[model samples]
Target chain A: MKNSLLSIYNIAKKDLLIELRNKDVILSISGFGTIIIFIFSFAFDVGSSLSSSTAAGILWSSISFASITGINRSFMLESENDTLEALIMAPISRDIIYLGKVVGNFIFITISEMVILPIFAILFNFSILSLEFITCCLLANIGFSVVGTLFASLSIKVRAREVLLPMLFLPCIIPILFSSIEATSMIFQGKGWNDLSIWFQLTVAFNLIFLIFSLFISNVIYED
Target chain B: MSNIIKNKLLTCSAIFMFINLYLIFIWVPTEANQGAIQRILYIHVPVSQISMLAIILVAVSSVLFLWKRNQFWDKIAISAAEIGLLYGTIMLLSGILWAKPVWGVWWTGEAKLTTALILYLIYVSYIMFRNYFPTGSQGQRIAAIIAIIGALDTPLIYFAANLWSEAHPPIVLGPASENDSSFSSNDMRIVWLFSTITFMIFFVYLLRIRYKLQDTISKYLTNT
Candidate 1:
């Protein structure tokens, strides 16, 4: 288990390293996210209507779409190089590979959310210092990336995979999207944890379920 | 040897379908509220239940195919998916048809309807992916992986509606909430039970035939 964990770390590090050098995935994801926020801001006049209450939804949705863009490009390197084939043939277990990709995606999206959240707040005229809302944003972002990465790995091999990943993923993410939006609303409204506990529990439950499931299937999926 | 068994199974399926049609259309009385329109429930609810069951069968068969490395399980998974898609479409159509009279719209932004629509899209893409890749090409393995990932939506689609506020049809069976009174009386209970069983039998009959059809195509292709 320790060896597997270390392998996962290395694989995750490798993914990050590649992305850093190319900067293509991160740039596009954050850029796309920024454009979406600006477009929505103009269309809905979100900049003026922005309250602590609605701020969280805008931030999370922007982050979610950004991550989808990043995940699509994250695999472009592997698809071009056959490096994924070599990784599978290595001594590492497939679960490590799955975990590595998920974690790397998690980090990538987290960065995007960090950038998007503040800009969203400023644009919407909401304060960004609420601790509870920030924490919820972090957790929800992680949950989304974990599931998104798994779907990316699964769909990146298909034809018109760009369209297929979101089609396959957005439905499953509805619950996460709901809870995140709801929990954020509650926090903005100054509601107590008693009112929002179910959403948090749901987020935790969904993350664990998808993590275990994705790990088990990654071996079959990654095999040639 | 198996030809006789196949013939017998097909005959049994035809009889079961005949009995199901008689039970649902001729015997069961219309509900008090929805009247003639409520009859669509007889078709919609049964087909939706069977589609969920068929999806489970597809998931289980795919897992078996991966574990055992047997083409038989793969073939079974493929066929079950085909049947599941067919039933899923019927469920959605009947659902929309039922909604038109009762909900005053052909479709609603209800969580259940949205999730079901997404489920249909995911599996449909899975089939499209399979077709895009040539037989015996790497796409078969790729398609199976997508099938497994898409199957993850089954549970999410089932529960998302309950977690979110929607105008979708309420759950009728199991631990009834304060809404239990809506389905009061022994007569309603018996009819519900009868309809559920009738649906299960009809599902099995369809599955048996679909599986044989799959076997024939696979065998014929191999022989040619």
Candidate 2:
């Protein structure tokens, strides 16, 4: 267990270091996320009767779309350098690699969300900086990162991965998207934790199920 | 041997389909509220149920494929997903037809309807994954992973939609209560059961043919 944890940490650290050096994924994702928010504001006429729920929906939709780009980049980076092949040949288990990528993708997506949220708040004229809103974001991100990384790895070998990743990832993340939007909307409405607890629990449940499930099946994708 | 079995199953399904058509149109009484349009339920409900069952079958076969590393289970998983997608498409279309006259709309954000659409999309992506990565262990592995994750995430999808629909009460047109005895009548119950069984048998029949077709294609590919 200890060794596996170390391996996972090491792999995640390597990915983070590479990302820090390049900064391509984070920049592109955050840029795309900002563009989506801007477009949504214009398209939806955000200044009018934009409810908090609508704002929440727009915010999540941007994050979800941007995260798809980020997921593709992360896996593309690994596969580009044949880093995935080398890692597969290494002593580390496939689940360890999966956990590592999940951690890495989670951090990347979180960073992009940080950039997107402020822009979303400014454009949509809503304050989403509350603790409850952030908590919901974090929970939803965990579910997204876990499931996204698994699918990203799976789609890495496909020819039209850019198109395929979102197709595969979007439906699976509907629960997270719904829960996050609902919880955030409720938080904005001054609903207490008691009212929003169900959404939070649902997000956490999705995260747990995907996390454990990805761990168990991650090896199948890499194994010949 | 397989050809003989396939022919027998095809004959059985055709016979059952004819019986189902007769039972739906003539034997079953028209619903009081929905009138003749409600007869779509006989086909829609059974196909929808079978589609869900096919997804479960895909998940089980995926597990088996991953564990055994056998192409047979992989074929079964893909074949089941394809057949599931067909049934899901039928369910969605038949649902829209039923809803048009009944609900006065082709679509609604209702929980069950939305979940079924998402499930259909997920199945489509699963087939797309198979097509995109045609010949590798990578493709098979990724498809298996999708099947497993998609199955695990389905209930969460349903629950999230349920929660969402609760916040904004849907404009429901059909039954007012959950336990409305539309099917509680002896005749309705019998027809419902028979249709469900017939659909299940039909699902198996399609699955067998699809599996055989996939097997033949793979064999031909390898030989050439």
Candidate 3:
């Protein structure tokens, strides 16, 4: 068990280190996220003062799109370098590799969110700096990373992976997106913590379920 | 498994479906509230039920494929998914037909319809994933992983959709809403039950044919 944990940590660290060296994934994700937010703000004319729910919808949608771009790039990086095959060939189990990628993706997406959220708040004229909002974002990111990593690996070999990744990932994470959007909107609306509790629980449940299932199936998917 | 049995089953299902169409269009009393359009329920409800069933079958077969490493299970998974996609499309169209007159809009973000649409998209992506991979164990493995992950997410999707719908004022547009208690009547129940059975048989017949087609294609590919 300790060995497995160590392996997972090492793999995750390796991926993170590579990402740090290149910085392409982070730059692309943040750029794409900002562009999406800009378009949505202009399209919705947020300067006229948007409803909290509309703002929440726009914010989450941008994050969702950026996450897809991030996920695709992350796997594409591995595939381009043939590192994915090397990882599979190593003594480490596929589940450990999956866990590593999940961790790596979670970190990347969280960092991108950190950058995106401040811009979103400034542009949309909403205060999203609260603990509840951050917690919801974290929980949603975990669900996204777990499911996104699995789908990213699956789509890595496909010719049209650019199109396939979002197609495969979005529907699977609808519940996470919905709950996060709901909770975030509630926070923006100044609703009480009790109102956000159910969405929080739903997000947690979504994260746990997908995390476990992804772990279970990752080996099967990677064992080409 | 024999050709004779396949033909018999196909003929029986065809006849059963004809009987169901007659009962739906002619025998069943028209719903007073929705008039003739409500008859679409006979097709919509049964097809939706089968679509759900088909997805569940895909998930089950996917798990079994991963566990046993059997090509047969993979065949079953793909076949069910294909058939499910077909029926799900029918469900969506019939739903639109019913919704236009009843809901006064062709589409709404109502939970059930949204969930069905997402589910259909998921299946479409699943088929695309299967096709993108070259004919090999690798493709099958990836598709199985997708099927398993999708199945796990299904309940979460339902929960989130229900929560979203509840938070907003209920849309009284769909046939499954509280106001449509027509199924509470004995005749409606009987007819619905018969239609459901007929559809189930139809699902089985289609699945067998699809499975055979996949098997033959795979065989031909290998021979070539």
Candidate 4:
């Protein structure tokens, strides 16, 4: 178990190093995310106090779109280098490699989200850098990365990978997307912790299910 | 699996459907609140339930396909996915038909409708993925993973949709909604029971036919 953990960490570290060199993955995520926030920023009055829920919806939908594209690029890069096949050929278990990619994807998206959130707060006139907000966003990002990694790898070989990725990814992520949006909205509205607990539980539970299921499914999909 | 069984299923499904139609029309008294339109429930509810069952079948068959590495399970999963999409379309259409008169709108973004629509979209995309992916074992494995995720997503979607809908009130409840005790008469129960049975049989027959078509096509291609 410790060895497996080490392997996962190593794979994640390797992925991070590669991402750092070109920075393509992070740039694509932030670029796409910024464009979305830019559109919403211009569409709504710059200083208008948007409804907390509307702000939450805008934040999440943009994240959803950007993160999916980010995931597609993450794997696309790996495939271009043939590293995915090499990793699959390695002695380490497939799930370990999958978990590694998920971790790498999560960190990349989170870093970009940090940059994106402040801009959204300024444009939408709502602060969301609070502890509760970060917690909710992290939970949602975990979900996005977990499900996205699996679908990205699965779709890499498809004829229409670009078009098909979002279609496959969105439906599966709806629960996480809604839970995080609602949870963050509640926090923005100054709702009690008791109310936020349900959404928290939902995001955590769905993330766990998708995480475990993705690991299990990875073994089969990655097999020779 | 055999001609005799298929024929038996076909005959029994026809007879039961006829009996269910009779029960829906003549046997169950007209609901005073909604009048004759309430009869759509007999078709809608059963189809909805069976459509959900089709999703479960897809998931289970997908799991078996991945575990056993058998094409037969893949065939079952694909067949169920196609049929689930059909039944979901029927459910949605019937719902809109009833909602127009009862709720004063063709559809509402209510919990039930929203959940059904999302679940239907999940399967539709699942079918679309199977179509877009190439015909190969790797494609089958990926599709199976999609099926499993889609099935497991149903309950979470229902729960989240329920929570989200509370912020926006649904239209006035039309009587004979599954929740309405007034609709729970012995007559209603009888009609619902037979209708569900008829639908189940029809589903089974359709599944067999779909599976056979798949088997024949694959066999023909291999021979050619």
lDDT of 1 at A131: 72
Clash count, predicted structure 1:
0
lDDT of 3 at B87: 96
Clashing pairs in 1: none
DockQ, each predicted model:
0.37, 0.80, 0.80, 0.68
Which stretches of candidate 2 lie above 4 Å from their native place?
A: A1-6, B174-181
Which pairs in model 2 have colliding backbones?
none
lDDT of 1 by residue, B1-224 (tens): 66676676667656765766676577667566656666566567767877877777777887677777777777777777788898898898888776666656677555667667777777787777676555653555666666776677556644655566532254332222222132434554555566666666656556667777877876887798
Q: What tens-digit string does per-residue lDDT give for candidate 2 at A90-197?
A: 988899989888888899989888899888878877777778888898998898898888888887778899999999899999999998888888887888889989
Q: What is the C-alpha RMSD of each candidate to the true structure, in Å?
A: 4.4, 2.1, 2.0, 2.4
Write model 3 residue lDDT over B34-76, tens digit each, in one string. 6788888888999999999899999999889988989899999
| Sliding window of 10 residues with minimal summed lDDT for model 2 chain A | A215-224
lDDT string for model 3 (A179-200, tens) is: 9888988999888788999999
> Model 4 lDDT vs. the true structure?
0.86
TM-score of chain A of each: 0.93, 0.97, 0.97, 0.97
Query: What lDDT does each candidate get?
Result: 0.72, 0.86, 0.86, 0.86
TM-score (chain A only) of candidate 3: 0.97
* CA displacement after TM-score superposition, residue B27 of candidate 4 (Å): 4.3
lDDT of 4 by residue, A1-224 (tens): 99999999999899899888999888899889989999987798667778888888899999999999999999998878888889999999899999999999999999989878888877887867578888898999999999899888888778778888998788878888888888878988988778899899999999998888877767776867
